[model samples]
Target: MTTAVDVLVVGAGPTGLTLALQAHDHGARVRIVERRPEAFRPSRALIMHPRTLEVLRPLGVTDALLEQADTAPKATLHLGSRAVEASLADLALPDTAFPHLSLVRQTDVERVLAQALADRGVAVERGTELVAVRDDGYGARAVLRTPKGPEVIRCLFVGGCDGPASTTRACAGIGWHGRPYTEEVVLADLDLSGTPGGSGAQLFAGRRGLLFLFPLGEQATWRLLATRASHGGPGPDFGQPGPPVPRSELQHLLGDAGLDARIERLAWSARVPLQFRLARRFRRGRLFLAGDAAHNYSPATGQGMNAGVQDAVNLGWKLGFAASRPHDSTGGRDAEVLLDSYDGERRPAACRRLFLTHTAFWAEASTGPTPSWLRAAAAARAAPLVPVILQRRRLVAEGVRVISQLRVNYRRSPLSVEETPHLHGAPRPGDRLPDATVGVGGPPQRLHALLARPGVHLLLQRDAAPPPHEVLGPHVTALRVANSPGRGLVAVRPDGHVGFRCGKVDAAGLSGWLSLICATGQPPGRPRPPDDAG
Candidate 1:
């Protein structure tokens, strides 16, 4: 049978599910297919970075996810067996309401987002696979294999959220470009009985290799990851429950530092390489690649899953915008320029993440025979520099503040004026405002909420003319403020940001700003589902 939708998403994981939900909300018909018959029960990627939390707040899912899981706001580093804890609270992130990172399982987060979508009446198709994809200018066509039968689906666009060996990516003919890491690491989930030297995510390094313990839940369950032997037996497959590690191996791994813990449940295990790579191109005609399909990074910092989530957010609105306009003023359904921005912006950003993450892991786990005395001495000398390096590492390495979707600026966009004061300095139309307790509210509402109603927020100075305020109607808001530097008519995008800002609120500037965004603005990509009329 042949089916049709605005978007065909091939993967029911976090990235694919999110894209489908947002597209459906944007009034674009979407279908998601996953090879797995059901959602995984065990947790994966337990750390929910602050930035991902901030992105979910607007979607109305952050609170629910937090309720299901707990936060590990602090992570400790053990240098030469001595622990030095660093509170994520110390780091500064002006963009996000969630200034600190949270430790929540991937399964829990997926459940929350999935339930959110189901509540809105969208469901993902499981035990299905995207067998073939062919793009022919007007749209892309996909063939999916479901238990019932073979089905053909055609859409204006397709987003591949499938994992590294994505069939959709191959169908689109996108090529990967990077080398795999030499060392392989094994990760296993365990119900830990022994006490670790530190709480939160703990890092233990020695000549044997590096041991990383990530807190899962209740402080009893945790994840243990370490370098696997080059010539040892094959590592356990992640698809099945893993074999327990011998107490002797655990003793040898921990050495004199102390950690003879009994493990209860072995959820999953896998031999992972520290690999970094990106797809040559994100978009091929009407099809787009996102998450792991577009780029792959080391799991050392737990950024792989987070980066994929951001991809869906960035592309969702653009696809929604193009698909929403039944026909542009140009009498076409597609906006090539608008669609082009997805790859232009995201590719560079993803590449930077891959490079930084690789650098961090290499430094953290570099293996060579060094004397015990030398290692202890090095740790003492490196204490001061650790905090500074960690802070910058957390920020840029993780792209925590900006890439998390807090302070993204389209100021350099071809659709935007290449000139504006925000372009030259701090606090631009795109940069997220520092969390401030404005008025009676504590921590106040985000700057985004003020411009949430719709259209441009023309912050006119007290004496300036309001411009043709009527032309913007309910879509635009002209706020007259007193003594605010952020004043002056600022055109805000539908997604909530100052699209254009003028020194003074003038009719000409307002008109120009409105024209540019209207011609380019995209609505938030979330749909009310088919039966959401109630």
Candidate 2:
């Protein structure tokens, strides 16, 4: 019964790095490995929705991420001869701190997460790859291919944070369901002239697909994400790169869009196929799938990497909680329920996103008759209809919020329980309470700041604060809001989702929920992390 580590993370991308950080911070022995020899890779995902920043804020990386964000990145939609402009900066997302979509490179985000892992004394095992895994009766065993040679490692849990071609997923016998899109997506880095400013995006709706030009604050001034028809070239198959997009082709596209722009230099270019896929299941006993391993999103609204990071955060905290407990805890039944909830919550979220992207791609990229007609109708009414739609502030904000994924919730989850049915107009048990200031008389604190800490949190109205004699949990942090209208109590799980909600400050209800979530056989609040430990 000796184990090498508490958790084995099989990829070093954003998801794996995030999972490794969360598990380790929660007192689990975590080891993250990557097959890629180099720490960074070229990627097409560049937009960070407000929801992404909101979740990462608690992990103490949002400030670093914002440093690299183009906060004022504007988005203009071009419909043939006419254009409709909408500034993300103007989106009225008043519930959260981040109100606009951020324009930043994928590499910058990975760099920040990787550095955070290093700061915690956990270096990613470069050139190490997971080759096989199995859920043994006691724990799990993973066979890996390292630079030196093949090695076998035993750990309590095996996490598959690897990308689309995840060996861990394959090893766990999970099914990958979906197909590749016929259109070609080309990503490029170049220097260009005639952009409105140097830090926004110009979007064009083509008959074939959507085309975009973005300003990247890197060696290249702009990033290109334009779609094209496949020539059936004798090169890579679908879902893989075919060849580099030629400069002549890019020049013609810019001209067709009426940008009157000139390409000064094409620093780098890659052709990627647009595809959508999601694993049949996210978990198999002790083996779990996350990030691209769990699902692959089409390149639309920049959800590919953003969703993966969110998947990491959701699964990371649950794994941390399970790993910190002993084998005999609850005779194993409740821990299994906690682990199972990861798949329960994330799979549906992935399905919802895939449905949205599929509909969008069909309307804009597919060659069907309905899509063709819709495009023609849009182009025909662009001048009059588009401007009127964009003028409605509330409507525009709603669209922005949907794109930012701020409304994702898990109300149906078993982990979400409402003890009091009278509560209304506030976030329910599975919904994220919008960020607000909370405290009694001391310095006011942001609700998200409290959630960002490493463990479960209990938020109570000032008059509802539990007495010291009450048994909370080993890792619980309690906060009392000074003037909450309703004398309610809420328990927020580690990943910032509300786990329990009650109309009254019922200590018994909070204690019962703690027994369901916390590690057993420990003093109440024995291992609470400090406020600044986030």
Candidate 3:
């Protein structure tokens, strides 16, 4: 039988699952499909950065993740003969609840999101493969290979969350635009003994490149990620893993980096080809590229998964809000603007992330003579001063924040609108709404907690009234805070970024931003399920 959905998500990985959850949470009738029957892929990413945790907060799955995730793991940097204990846990980032990175496998993240979607009655169609997707004027028609037979699905949008070799991207006529790194990351989840530090993480830096050991606490106790040292060789094949990273090779690499720990028993191992690639375009027609399909980063700083999740969140809500609006309501202009902003906002993020991962990869793993000398110099110099550098609170906090992607903002986005006078260092429109204590007549409550209630929130300060429904339109909730440090009207978007801000409530400005994102005139409280398109 043919099916109809608002968003037809291809690839049921972390990005696709999260995208499905957010779209369903914000209103779209989402159907996520995975080409693979089961999630047998390797969990290459283990650390969930603070910004990613915060972004997943509103999806109602962050708490579950936090319960299972390790947020307080100590880190030790292996600098030749000396080991410097680095603490990202003590960062002075008070604005966010997740100041430190959380140690959890990418598989767990997918499981959590999949369960959340199932709870909302949206089960992933496993073993479902996308055959073709062609635009059909008002929406798109996708052909899928289901167990029963060839099934057709009519969806307002198609989300391509598959990996670098994305079928959806190909179907959209988009090609990968970035290059692959020579070095490949070897992943092994095993138990270790004779380790020098607590059950946390260890980073080894030297001419050979960076090696990471983390207490995964899932599938295995320790997760080791080391970049293979090769002399300007051809990149490993993408998609499927190459071979099992042997135990003896791991031991040799371990001893070379100054770790005395021995692998007790190898639980799982896979070689991930490191690639730095981005899509030619994030969107084409009614299709949108997300996750690894949109951008693939070398396993330099664990950006591929995090960036993909952020991309999903950025595009999901826009899809939900836009799909909720009838095509004739605003002549599809409203939906177009919201959909357009997905590329405008997320494509740049991918570009910036590509630069960051590329730079890190080049310095750490590049095999040229000059690059090797530079690496040796950095490794030799870094070991001595690493201890002293970790002592600086400001520098450490900034570094952590930057790597955590907490400071990522969309100030230049078309959806971002600011009318308030510039208060130096104060929060502005397009910033992720910083968390603060909000008095609700009792002790206190978190601003993020209240904003998590759902929809675009109009937060009023000190008993200020919210704009009427006629002005701001549907799917907007307004709440007055009892005690707020800053007095102004802040419109927090569904994805938790400040969409509109003003010293006072400017109803017109708020409405414009809402309309721009197609947040205005949605189907009342809950977005009505889209009519069957088949």
For every model shown, the clashing-pair count is 5, 0, 0
TM-score of each: 0.81, 0.92, 0.92
TM-score-superior candidate, 1 or 3: 3
Q: Considering only N, C-alpha and C atoms within 3 Å, which residue pairs clash in candidate 2? A: none
Give the alpha-carbon lDDT of every model: 0.63, 0.77, 0.77
Q: What is the lDDT of residue 285 in candidate 2?
A: 86
Candidate 3 per-residue C-alpha lDDT over 292-373 given as tens digits, one digit per residue, 9 for 90 to 100: 8988888777787788888998988888888877767574887787888889888887788788878888877776676676
Better of 2 and 3 by TM-score: 2
C-alpha lDDT of candidate 1 relative to the true structure? 0.63
TM for candidate 3 is 0.92
Q: Which residue pairs come into collision in candidate 1?
A: 24-527, 25-526, 25-527, 26-526, 26-527
Residue range 1-534, candidate 2, lDDT tens digits: 234898999988788888898788776799999988996556556888888887777678889988987887777777766677767775677778887778888888889999988898999899987877899977898888899898888998988988888888998899999987776677778887756432357887766566788766355877787776655556554445558888988887677555677889888776877668889999998999998888886676678888888888888878877877656757367678788999999999999999987777777667666776666556756556877877777788798777767788999998888886345655788887688876656577777765776777777655564624445556777776665765677778877788889878666766667756765334434544223211
* Candidate 2 weakest ten by summed lDDT: 525-534
Clashing pairs in 3: none
Ten-residue stretch with the least lDDT total in model 3: 525-534
lDDT of 3 at 11: 90
